[model samples]
Target: MTTSVSIFPIRHHGPGSARSLEHALSQLNPDVVLVEGPSDADPVLPFLTQRGMKPPVALLGYVNDDPARAAFWPFAAFSPEFVAFRWAARASARFMDLPASATLAGERRNDDHDDLHSDPLRVLAEAAGHADFERWWETLVEARGDDFEVFDAINEAMRAVRADAPPPTGREAQREAHMRQTIRAALKDGAVRVAVVCGAWHAPMLDVDAFKAKDDAALLKGLPKVKVTLTWVPWTHGRLSVGSGYGAGVRSPGYYDHLFTTRSAVTERWFARVARLLRAERLEASSASVIEATRLANTLAALRGRALPGLDELNEAALSVFGWDSDLPLRLIERELVVGEALGEVPADVPTVPLAQDLAKLQKFLRLKVQPEQIDLTLDVRTDNDLARSVLFHRLNLLGVPWAKERYAGGRGTFKEAWALAWKPEFSVQLVEASRSGQTVHDAATATATDAARTAGTLAELTTLLESVRYADLSGATPVALAALDARAAGSADVSDLLEALPPLARLARYGDVRGRGSESNTLAGGTFRTLLTRAGVGLPLAGVGLADDAAATLRGKVNGADAAVRLLDDPDALRGWQAALTRLADRDDAHPLLNGDAVRRLRDASVLDGPEVERRLGLALSSSVPLEVTAWLDGFLDDSGAFLIHDAGLLALLDDWMTGLDATVFQETLPLLRRVFSRFGKPERRAIGETLRGGGAAGRGVRRELDEDRAMLAVPVVLRLLGVTT
Candidate 1:
């Protein structure tokens, strides 16, 4: 019997194409079915027909040695190629695709080249006077009933498109040649009936008799080959959208899915779903509105000369019937219904690296669902489960698989941590790559961090790495990081670097007990803190001298941070050393006025300098310094604390007298700085200070004033009651 070959051209991920292909395949009953996919992925093809296998999954092909070099062949339920696979499986026929080894081994192509073959659809849509190719396809094909004649139309259109288009060359030529070769091999294997399902653009070039075998072989000749591993990974609907940068992606996977799944009452059911979602969000969407929306959508479709309502018509109907003023409701519909952000599931037995499997088990145990949408997770380290979750997040971050990004935990306390978690499909390949370090997440993180710490060249880098290690609870990596930190700190003469290094160490020392590491972490972190602080104290005096304004401002911030760290540690010896360094900076005549003023403020805030001494220093600096220097010193002194001026009448009086005495040019030049200082105050505090200035500034100094003795005596009982005293 002569083998009859039938080519079924299809649009990738088209529901109508999938339906028509299924109908055509059942009628033809082909013995061999060829699809356009990676030939090396044949081994895992059986998994597609197995139970628990879901749509929105991808065939992941990666280099054996370096999994970072990877490619994805994604499929949705409505994808024509996916439908062909199921049909072939049910009919007990052979199915295969072109080899992906050459493709994976080749240099990564730009997205332009990746999507070049799909341009025929754009040309056809443009010729049809449609602006969007997806909408054009949806109207002409996806909205139609299952009919095999649609394939014939697509084949004819693609043939016309290819006639004027240049012949395929480079990688595109090789892929089509390999595809034809696969078909020829199937036909030569004594199959009486052969069916090929491929991209519409490539269909015109795949006639085996028209292209000689030698030409196809020569086209594939000299192609680089590499060992590649293939596995199935879960994909997301969001990733299936063109907005996500998938070159061959559809504009509306979720809408296409609804079209494919809903066999009857498509418009009514869609409106019902919209109403249900709106009601779920506590928005008013009544049954009458749903009915009106369905009718309106159908009417719009009729007016637009469409057989059924497309997504655009339905969205308009919903907007009109629901009477929403803002586009927020529409956006919610687009995100939740149009794009449908959902992560697909893979069978537990699917092939993956050990690290990926381990992570899956951990996710299940921790009650963390792998989702495509980002979720904010707040963890309290005081709880065992939360602490474990935090550790896992930190470990994954250390492994360079940032599934969770650490965000600021509001309202202080080291026990609280906040993270933004979102799972991407590419993390599977990242897990495979990270598995080279170790077979498990924790072990891999430790290995990666330890390697980083050993290679880290700067004291600041070592300190930051050590902090991450502590957070991850990587006990194995902590010692290596601490050793590296010590070695780097011992040789570093940069006081700024030393100061930068001290804060994380101080935090580790103070909060180690809270992290469940107990006294061991405390001792190690405490020792490091003392060493860095001593070095910083030694170099700080010289570092403070001969600095520019910007550098002085930056160093002042570092000083503030280091002081806060020392105060957090609350060790008297560390505090004494830090205070001595500040004293030296405060007494230096050659230091920038800003730093000098900040140092004096720090000393006064620490109460090491009494009130009289602070007054003396302030008076001398204002009288002896230039107008610019006086302004800078006042800024450093009053940084972020306008309440201080309100509370200290003598200091405020000194500042007022200096400012009032300045010449007009000097006052105007310093006006901006004065405004900056006052801007930090709260509205009420600013008003109170202004009122104090207007009232001759005696209220803040507790000047004696006349009072009604009888009224005061009457409030004594209320005061005693507030104090809980019994008379």
Candidate 2:
């Protein structure tokens, strides 16, 4: 039996188009319906129909064809395709997607389409009946609230564009080819009638005869395909948003989400909700203020003769009403209302990897088990432990689980991880979303793992990076990915930041112990782990918790952080950097003691000091103290680590050198400056005066000390370098 099938190209979730699609699908009564997808997702349709599953979820599709190179397709709940899928399932229509599937030859095929979507955003004045495509579509199709008219207008508008702006290869080629294929497949099965639903752009291509004349098999020539799996995962408003992308009119998807969900969701409603949410959260906002702002928005809208306030009016209302005119509401309101409570369900029977399924179950369980923001959870995944808790935490993380780091972690290996879970709805949603980008746990964990390998500037960033990358490397992602990070810490002058990046990386590497990787890893891991501690050698003033972003992670700091410089006496990174920073603290003179203390401690800890080496260098320094090598070698240790330094170890010695200072000519110049320093800080600081009154402190003090080294340090060096002495 041969029956003419109708193909509808319409936008998903478009109330107007969807309404029309529903009616058309219901009326046409086609035998089979084809939707657009990677064909591999076809198997998941049954699972997608699960009652627990919700819309506003994405079909996370991945191509492992090339693990090194991958991309994603995210579909949200309000997506038109999802709705169509539901309609097909309900109708019991033999539904299927018509894109390349099972064979992902297309995954490897480079279509070179990046340039295709880059058509100019240029808008002609008043031609499309609205300011831009978005406004035009909203006014003509969406705002009218009439699906029939929406469908008609869409078909007409799309036809006009199709006729005028035909895609280079052929505007109507795809659907025509699809229609022929559908007809042939039906012919081979000896069944009739079919319907195809695709994007509006494909509408003009649906007529069967146009492509029936071509070789259907040949038309699919070189159309590659690959294995893929599609699972429903929640999507954020940002992903659906389209300020700049392929989708249209979703300038602020958060707003559209509100608008589309509730017919109008006017300004007052939006402002009121914001006020209420804030007040509920104890953020100090009032309903009266919101009402006032809503009135203002309404007034503004009336001036424009709009029935209700648009985004501008609502935004202004939010600002005028409850917003602090700065960025509080602007930051939070959208996330609260627009994305709202997005949740996706994966059926137990859905075909998926064990890890993925485990992640899903974990997320579902966590969804119901709400814990407070600040938390600490200790999980023991030992040989005899309950499998549930162990699997649960990993699953949450796999799903981007939100956990507050523990105050203190005890023990080592996967069996001993200290995890604090803060099971938030959004975190789980984000986790699910990440699945679209990366097929497995490792891939989705990119955000944390890659972020771990940071520039490591401050302890704050390093700690944050550590917290973020935790566990991401469990899938062997810790190679080149982590090398630069290790080198970064060693090179980092901020002793605190180096200290921070180490523990987390060490923890991850240690977890590899459970995975059975090796002892070299443990050595490298311990070496890397303790590297910061060693670098923080003794008497290095404790850098107070660099940042307390995580209460738990910073807990250990409160206990032992103040003692890092004092206790970790021989850590190399510490000695190298802080030792230099210590040398400059002399004039403040508060610094010399700190540095000298650290050097002394390092000597004690290492049970070694280059005494002869020191003496040899001391002779070389005196023989030629110049701005360059000869002069530089002559003076005491100094660097731009802190304030300027006078090289003499004690204040009295520094004063002695200043009094003796340079030469008769250099003395005339240096004496006045010494007198000035003595007058400025010399009196108020009793300790400085005491040091100055004291005797010569250390031989390395040389001519310069914390008391009298300045522009002269560089100047003296330059002169000595010129003298050509044996410095």
Q: Tell me, what's the RMSD of every candidate?
A: 8.8, 12.8
- lDDT by residue (141-169, candidate 1, tens digit) is 55454455667778888888679878777
Best by lDDT: 1
How well is each residue in 600-655 modelled by candidate 2, as lDDT tens digits?
33342343434444334334333433312222211123211111223324323433
Clash count of each predicted structure:
0, 45
User: Cα deviation of 297 in candidate 2 (Å)?
Assistant: 3.4
Regions of model 2 farther than 4 Å from truth: 1-8, 12-33, 63-71, 92-103, 106-138, 142-146, 166-176, 183-195, 213-216, 227-234, 242-250, 263-268, 339-343, 359-727
Q: Model 1 scores what on Cα lDDT?
A: 0.83
Checking candidate 1 for backbone clashes, the offending pairs are: none
